[model samples]
Target: MKNRIRDLRTAKGMTQEDLAEIIGVSRQTINAIEKEKFDPSLPTAFKMAQLFELPIEQIFLFEI
Candidate 1:
C-alpha cells in the first residue's frame, strides 16, 4: 500500500505523536504507517480519512 500520510501530516503541521494521539494510536504505529512498513486497520484508516478531511482512497493507494 502507498499513502500520503507523511505529506498530509506535515502539511497540517502535526508531528507523529500529535497525529497518533488524535487517532488513538502509538507514535510508532503512525511512523510505520507513514513509512509504508505497516498497513492500518479499517477503523484506523477511517480515522485518518476523517482527520485529514480526505477520502480513504485519496490518502491510501491500493495497487493490484
Candidate 2:
C-alpha cells in the first residue's frame, strides 16, 4: 500500500504530530504510514479520508 499522507499533510500545513493528534494515533504511526512501512486500519483510513475531504482510494493506493 502506498499513500499520499505526507503530501496531503504538507499541503494542509500539518505536521505528523498534528495529523496524529487529530486522527488519534501516534506521530510515529503517521510517519510509518507516510513511509509506507505501515498500513492504517480501515477506521483510521476513514478518518483520514474524512479529514482530507478525499475518498479512501484517493489517499491510499493499493496495487493489485
Candidate 3:
C-alpha cells in the first residue's frame, strides 16, 4: 500500500502532530502511515478522508 498522506498533510499546512490530533491517533502513527510502514484501520481511514474531503481511495492506493 502507498499513500498521499504526507503530501496531503503538507498541502493542507498540517504537521504530523497536527493531523494525528485531529484524526485521534498518535503522531508516530501518522508518521508511520506517511512512511507507508503502517496501514490505518477503516475508521482511521474514514477520519482522514473526512478531514481531507476526499475519498479513501484517493488517499490510500492499494497496488494489489
Candidate 4:
C-alpha cells in the first residue's frame, strides 16, 4: 500500500509524533506507515482517515 501521510502531515504542519499521539500509535509506527514499510491495522487505518478528514481511498492506495 501507498499513502499520502507525509505530505498531508507536512501540509497540516504536524509532526510524526503529533499524529501518532492523536492516533494512539508510536512515532515509529507512524514512520513505518509513512514509508510504506508496514501496513496499518483496520482500526488504525480508520483512525488515520478520521484524523486526516479524508476517505480511506483518498489517503491509501493499493499497489496491486
How accurate locally is residue 60 in candidate 4, as Cα lDDT from 0 to 100? 93
lDDT of 2 by residue, 26-51 (tens): 99999999999999999999999999
Which residue pairs show backbone clashes in model 1?
none
Candidate 1 lands at a TM-score of 0.98
Give the alpha-carbon lDDT of every model: 0.98, 0.97, 0.96, 0.94
How many residue pairs clash per model? 0, 0, 0, 0
For candidate 1, the per-residue lDDT at 13 reads 100
**Residue-by-residue lDDT tens digits, candidate 1, 1-64:** 9999999999999999999999999999999999999999999999999999999999999998
Summing lDDT over every window of 10 consecutive residues in candidate 3, give the lowest-scoring window: 30-39
Candidate 4, poorest ten consecutive residues by summed lDDT: 48-57
lDDT (tens digit, per residue) of candidate 3 on 4-62:
99999999999999999999999999999999999999999999999999999999999
Please identify model 3 stretches exceeding 4 Å from their true place.
Answer: none
Give the residue spans of candidate 2 off by over 4 A.
none
Candidate 2 colliding pairs = none
How do these models rank on lDDT, best leading? 1, 2, 3, 4
TM-score, per-candidate, Cα-based: 0.98, 0.98, 0.97, 0.95
